[model samples]
Target: MGAVRETLDAVRLVDHHCHGTVAADLGRDAFESLLTEGEAWPGISPFDSPAGVAVRRHCAPLLDLPRHTPAEEYLARRSELGRREVQRRFLRAAGTDVFCVDTGYAPDPLTTPREIAEAAGGTSYEVVRLEGVAESVQTAGVEPDAYADTFRTAALEAVRRPGVVAVKSVAAYRTGFDLDPARPSEVEVTEAARRWFARGGRLDDPVLVRHLLWTAVDLGLPLQLHTGFGDSDIRLHRADPARLTDWLHLTAGTIPVLLLHCWPYQRQAAYLAAVFERVYLDVGLTLHHVGPARAGGVLAEALEITPFRKLLYSSDAYGVAEFFHLGALAFRQGLAELLQGRVDADELSLPDALRIARWTGRDNALRVYRLEADGPEDD
Candidate 1:
């Protein structure tokens, strides 16, 4: 117990897939909204939920409050500290060594990758969102005949930026994983672009989406796919990573394909990771949402058949700074309990448990993202 817990406590994490925190101070309603994947409604508060309770139990202490502090009290204390102070306390307390931030989804002003690192005390790398790049190409206006080449060029250039480590797709939100596994031909792309340009809003055209995904393979960077359990926009059944079996097979041997957040479908995700050489997964969003108490259950399901090296840690912590602390706390507590129990039962040894802790929390991310060559940024 002492060995594994101590090892994980000291391990510095690489948040392989996350989004920026809000730069502005938030009121109760606004802060609560970020705590949930669902919208706020009358008679319901995110404070009553698992994620909210976790914030009070776990994050309260970081803000100089006791565990299980009441929601109103918690927010009042946060207000007294100022948003920047609150953000600094939580981010620094998270002890994350590197942040691979998805710099795309910004409905509100968010800290940039550099700003996040500056606040959190570590290096920050960018994860380009393929959908954002495609939409940018749309905004820049490309001829339908040239749309395929134009988007490909834009995506290519986006990943080539300094400190850019990976690319992400919200295909789960935009279309779903049930699309045809084959890459859309140039003619199909041009035709889709013609319809898309005429409609001119969000890029949900299945053909164009396929083009974007295939282009990610061509870009030669690890690809992160949003799979399972997001907001109302996701058709849950279609977001299952198993639905991506055909696509994964087609893109085999290209680059690492990371499945993010997988909650209800974690077993399905585990199956994919066990079978596919390049497939990897993290139950990031699930941790803070389930809270530390239930994190072990979610992690157990995710590790049922997932190869030891295939699992990674992430927060998927967007909008709120408390998630940064809660996510890491849950990971440490849940993983420590699970691995320590295995060692107690003689199913695992202490040394092996410690190694697994390091791999999942930090080393695997550096290996997958190829960030090892950069050495320690603090050095």
Candidate 2:
């Protein structure tokens, strides 16, 4: 058990799914808004939440404050440090070796992929977003007949970007997973594209969204899909990964499907990972939101039936550098405790526990994205 704990502490993580941090300083209002999955109401501070407390206890020290510093003082210290140094400190503290960043959603100014890589002293790779490409095609005025082909071509080009390791979709935010599993015919896609262009807003039409996913499959890169838990945009019940069963069946053996942030549905995700050879999952955003205290419980549920090889580590950190620090802290602490307990109980051998810790924290992601070759074993 002691050996297991020591190994996880030293294992450099590969954050397989995350977003870039901001490039500029944030006022209290802007900063608080990024802290939660919902809007900050008139009176309540995001500082009162689990994530907030975690930051104060875990991340405050990195900014040169005592643990559990008051929120007001914490914010003041952050503003005093300025932006670049803040990012550098937090990214370095995370001790991550590689970052697979999703460059899709940036409501605020964010560090670019290269900037993030530089700040952390690690490699950074891109995960292209599927819907952003389709929306761009619409904004660029493609003819209805050309929409399907144009989107497919654009997506193909997007993945060819030098650092792109994979592609992602926020269909969970748009239409949910009850979508029909079958691919739309060319005619259906053309008509759906025509309606979408006329409606002229987000690309939410069910048919077109499915087309985007299938296009992801055709591109043959590993595809990441937002699963349970997100901002107000997600319809909680509809976002369940179980609803994706048929779609998974239809696309089986086509490409790897990585489920992101499956909380509350971590069990469902674990079930899927048990059955689907190409399916993988991570409880990323969920960890930061639950904070360090509950990270072990959440991780235990995610690993209950999940194959060790099918689980990967992610921060899903966006906008806030505190999350980069907190997420890594929570993962290392929680995963270490859980695996060490198994070793103590004699449920797993010392060697097996160490292997699982290494796989979940780093090696699994490296293999999933094919960043580099790893030995073939599921220890």
Candidate 3:
């Protein structure tokens, strides 16, 4: 008990993946207001029907509306939204000191890179991480198969960036389910990705995902994959994390692949994490769907069997600052207490408690991202 308490106390964690920068740009007040009004941010799909719209209005304030204006208005708000003041305020709720900003769609060249670096340095945390995916397929109308070379080139370049710390692919079903891990062979998937690129689809295809995995392994880099259940249209059957066995087998001992929030399928995800040697996971969307109570239970169950060291903290924070702030705070408190069990209250040690927190909080990301090592420091 003392050691667990001490472990949780010494924890120094980082949110491996977050869209805090986008929330910062929204200005706290604006974000709060919009959230109250029921607008959806980019991470979760937008509402389409009148009923959905009504639901968002009721649920908006509960969301961390990290932004106020439309995508077109981002540039003018950069200066104020990019500052450390908002970041510090946000971190006060969650005990993290660093976060990685995913700048996949910054319109302004200067703003995009600058935001990444600056956000890291902001009060809530430091280190702005950059990432790049094969935009050639979607933007160029090329076949998914044709984009392999282009993806490779882009990934190589992204890896070279000074602040980039990881590589990722947005190929899986973002709706409510996970992709069938048993689906096509890696080669088949890669070819499909190439064709998707050729067709001018804006999303990464299977080919790019295969190439990204191989490249990450070769470079000793960590890769984040959009797994589990997300979006509304995703097939629940395909969303099971169990199907990732083959994929995990392929990357075993080579490079780490993080499964992001399989939610309803978290048990499945946890089971896979327990079996895989190099797999890691995060509960990104659970903040919204599972609530703090259930989230605590789910996470505790996962940590009890799988190595606690393999878990990482993340909200997949996007659209609003409050969402990131509160979600993170809830995770910290929930996870901390969950790990404590029925220990003597007077025996609690902040350092031990923090250390436990770090295992799932920041240490996992550091190890997976290989951030402490001296190298290119990018993907």
- lDDT by candidate, in order shown: 0.91, 0.90, 0.54
For every candidate structure, what is the RMSD over all alpha carbons to the true structure, in angstroms?
A: 1.8, 3.4, 7.6
Q: What is the lDDT of residue 14 in candidate 3?
A: 71
Residue 187 in model 2: lDDT: 97
Clashes of each: 0, 0, 66
Model 3, stretches more than 4 Å misplaced? 1-10, 23-88, 105-132, 137-146, 174-198, 204-212, 342-354, 373-379
Poorest 10 consecutive residues by lDDT, candidate 3 = 122-131
lDDT by residue for model 1 (1-379), tens: 4799899999989999988889898899999999999999999999999999989988898888999999999999999998888888988998898999898899999988887787888888999999999999999988999988888888888877888899999999989988999998888999999999999999899998898889999998999999999999899988999999998999999989999999899999999999999999999999999999999989989988999999999999999989989899899999999999999999999999999999999999999999952333220
lDDT of predicted model 3? 0.54
lDDT of 2 by residue, 205-297 (tens): 999999998989999999999999998888989999999999999998889999999988999999999999999999999999999899999
Q: lDDT of model 1 at residue 87?
A: 81
Q: Please, what is the TM-score per model?
A: 0.97, 0.97, 0.68
Candidate 3, residues 1-379: lDDT per residue as tens digits?
Answer: 3455345445555767765334345543444333322455655433333322422332232234333333223323433445354444444445445565565644322223234334434322222221245553346454545555565566666666676666665545532223333334546755676465356544434444444556566655676766655554455576666776776776688778777766766777777778888888877756544545456776766665666678887766555444455556457656766756534464545555556576677677777776652223231
Q: Could you tell me which 10 consecutive residues in candidate 1 have the lowest summed lDDT?
A: 370-379
Report the lDDT of model 3 for residue 80: 42
